[model samples]
Target: MPLALYMLGLAVFAQGTSEFMLSGLVPDIAADLQVSLPVAGTLTSVFALGMVVGAPLTAVVGLRWCRRRALLSFLAAFVLAHVVGAITTSFGVLLATRAVGALANAGFLAVGLATAAGMVEANAKGRATSVLLGGVTLACVAGVPAGALLGQLLGWRSAFWAVALVSVPAFHAILRWVPATTSAATGRGAGPSGAGASGASGASGARAGDFRARRELRALRRPRLLVLLALGALVNGATFCTFTYLAPLVTGPAGLAEAWVPVVLALFGIGSFAGVTIAGRLSDARPMRLLVPGGLALLVGWLLFPAVVDHAIAVFALVLVQGALSFAVGSTLIARVLYEAVEAPSLGGAFATAAFNVGAAVGPSLGGAAIGAGLGHRAPLSVSALLVAAAFGTAGLALAVRRVRARRGEPAGRTLTS
Candidate 1:
């Protein structure tokens, strides 16, 4: 792995903390801004929505710039948004800032993922994807909890300030370590030397822009990658739906005190960290071996969650296991997306980023709608189960497509499950 990979991970950690921390501060924000709880909750929704919108919007615009320029531009905007968020007193201002920040975050993750994969050998792409995603899991474990703590001790705005402060170093790291441009090394055959193909060993940034933007847009029509994108949305929907509702489930159904909420969430984070670590080691070598069991286990966990939520110890244990399986399968799915997106270059990251954010926006909305309609905490778990099942079906479709391609002896260049 390149030093820039770690830098990307660190940058992800900085930005991801803000993505998850607002849930803890919604009440404070509402109270301070003189808004209802529901309005305040829209902060999170707005962020998710921005991420969905930002992926392709930025991808289209960023397709023209070099990898380092795009990354630095996104990171700068992200940090600026946080700084403004921390200072803003008006609800409208803060809302706009969240949208802006989410856009930057999405852009960074989208491009960062491609950059990370391009920096590694084909065989190591899975591990590289895991390494890049590790920052997100780590944020769930450490940065988010810490942000909440900061919010509790200082003010909600302090969390935003912290995110801005921590992210400064990542900007420097990107500028210093990542290559400003790609020549022969950035395109599909980033080959032995990885990033530059000629032993340049750049970060995971891909010159997906090497292809025309129209070609990148056409990549979206590919059925195999489309199925993978849908699958990504489904699996992510399941995980995030469960995640968004875990706190209420802990306090209401699990019979745990409020104080234990963060601890349980952290346990889930610990499980996620473990999952990413294990997946990083094995995903490159045997992705299906991990994905099959991990996905199945995640499905079972969701199905069992409603029944066992009343059991404190059992559910707590389940959170850890489910978290592990959720990320193992999710990360592997992303790695597979990268594999299939090899031809898309610039569009590859946007496709995966957009799909993941779509899930992020939809999953919790479905679960919340269930809750709003008077369904209980178990409602979200039910939603998660259905989503997981749907993901399984999508995965089967991907497999079938692969087989059909194999039988027809079509080019099948880097088809799914390849």
Candidate 2:
């Protein structure tokens, strides 16, 4: 609800656009760089790898700085990387720049979530996180499509330049509005105004340094917490496997025009926005219940994808459901991880984010391999269905673990159903 949250959303929008736009521009990038499409496609794979490597990597290093400072620093790095990507002519140089940008993107997100959670009252945590993540959904809806359009009109490099220009204002907004709260200081029983808690809120005035880092890492070692991370990874992997190649699928076998690809993707984005908004509120109230339905929706959507691809109307309708279901799981899973690692929510949340990135990295590689093996568009979708089923299984496993713990007279830690 704060003005700063809106600014943070803008920063996320720029980052998300830069991250997802590459998928749409893969052909252009390939042509411009004088490389094959599959080789050019590695741009995305490298970015995902950066995210997987960067999330926890930055989280560990960022423990020594104020959250606000770290966020600003990462955004600045993101801006620089985009600029480097826009100007570089060599394929290797562009790839390195993208990887660096990916690292910044990962750190920005991990810190951003932790920062947003710190910004609001405990009861409003889900809403705060949702608002932050909305930028990512918006990117899918608006940013990627627009970038693709720019690539079509100008060049792939031009699209990166445009993103770089957007990042300028985003960076300024972050520096001006984001508060300088450290992780430990932010967790002192609520905000400074007594808006959510009573008594001296600053009772536990710990410094943000090595001691805090060790404590946070220790909290993340819980089994229930680790399971949540794996679940997040699996679900994300399932989605991205098909999602990254959607444009190709729709245009190739689905018989859709290249121009319409962005529009359909935007529709999915609209669904994602709706899903995130609805799921954010529900997850905070009941995570386990939300996860069951969310996982089922994902499973059903993937299974039905093969049937719907040939018809425009069917593809549109299916994408809406797919987007909604896929994103709906985010807040619930995040809340579950944080709840389980109550003593050190930041590290647990960061680990879960890392897991998600790991999935992102794996999904595209698997999808690309399937496509490379002489299987067509259907291969990726079918594989996505299987992955979603595995995610469902993981969710079930999490639920069973909770029940077993409850019966054993031990704390179930946290319920995904909340």
Candidate 3:
């Protein structure tokens, strides 16, 4: 509920828009650049690759710097990347800009989450994390659609320009509103003179930071934890395969009008918002229950997608459920990763995020290839179904591991939910 959270949310919104708007603007970009659609599509893949490579790398590098400064610097880089992308005529240059933008994005998201957690009371950490991630939902529900409209009415370049415009406000807001506390300043070792005026405040701040750092480190060292992270990536990749081509899939086989594609995408975004909100609460309460059901829902949704594509109403309903189920697992998995790797949660969190980007990079390329091979628009959905099944298997594995560890009277890592 802090004003700082709102400011952070704005930055998150801008980042999410910049990351996702490419899906809506792919055609416009391809036409303007005079490149093949698939080639233009590589831009999204490149961005994901950047995130995969950048997440932990950025987190480690930023470890020595103040969290607020790291976040601000990354935001600036993100804005610059979009500005460069807006002006570039060469496809290669544009691709590089996107990569740079994604790298900055990785740093921003990881640092931003850590900073938000630092700002709030212990009981409010979940709420804080949700507020930060809410930016992603807002980007889907609001930012991507607006970007698509801008691309359609003005030019694709205008979409990037719009993204750039948001950066200035985010940059200033972060500077003005985000507090000046460094990881070191907030940690143990402040003298009695400084502690006396706010004794409990200083003690609590240091304890929270220490606990966070230790827990994050411990979570990263577990093998089962790594497996869970991989499962999340695979599940997401499966869904992304189908989702990346949604605009074409709906219009081509479903016989929907082109103008309605954005509206449909908006519906998916709304579903995402609902999913994230629900997932956060469920994961906080009963993560394993949420994980199993969510994965199964994804599988069911994908299996039904191909059959329902011919019916406009059915297809819309399916897409909404698919989006909701696919994204609903995110918060749960994030909490899972943090819980499992409690000693060094930041690295685990970063790795989990990197896994997500890996899935994003793989999904569309594989899906596009299937579509190119005369598999039809439905091919991607089939592939997604297979991936979701794999995800379900992984969840089962995580649960089994947890049970086995519990019975052995050993440290069973952290529980999935607190």
Best by lDDT: 1
Global CA lDDT of candidate 3, please?
A: 0.76
lDDT tens string, model 1, 1-418? 8888888998899888999998889999999989999999999889989998998778665665656777889999999999998888899999999999999988888888877887788888888888888999999999998998898999999999899888888777788866665321145333444333223223432333434466767766888778878988998898888899888988887888998998899999999989988888878778888888888888998898888888888988999998898888888888888777776665777779889889887898899999999988789999999999999988787777777888999755453446
Local error of candidate 1 at residue 180 (angstroms):
0.9
Model 3 CA lDDT for position 204: 62
Give all candidate RMSDs, comma-separated: 4.3, 4.4, 5.0
Q: Score every model by TM-score.
A: 0.91, 0.88, 0.85
* Tens digits of per-residue lDDT for model 3, 191-293: 5532432233456644554554555556576777787688878877986888788888989999999987877888888887787777766665567687777
TM-score of 3: 0.85
Q: Tens digits of per-residue lDDT for model 2 on 132-228?
A: 7788898988998899889889888888888777767766666776655444224523455322211222433223355667888887877777778
* Model 2 TM-score, all chains together: 0.88
Error of 1 at 241 (Å): 0.8
lDDT of each: 0.82, 0.76, 0.76
Assess the local accuracy of residue 408 in candidate 2 as a C-alpha lDDT between 0 and 100: 98
Two-way lDDT contest, 1 vs 3, winner: 1
Off by over 4 Å in 1: 183-185, 188-211, 398-415
Per TM-score, the best of the predicted structures is 1
Candidate 2 colliding pairs:
286-417, 287-416, 287-417, 287-418, 288-416, 288-417, 288-418, 289-417
Task: Give the true-structure RMSD of model 2.
Answer: 4.4
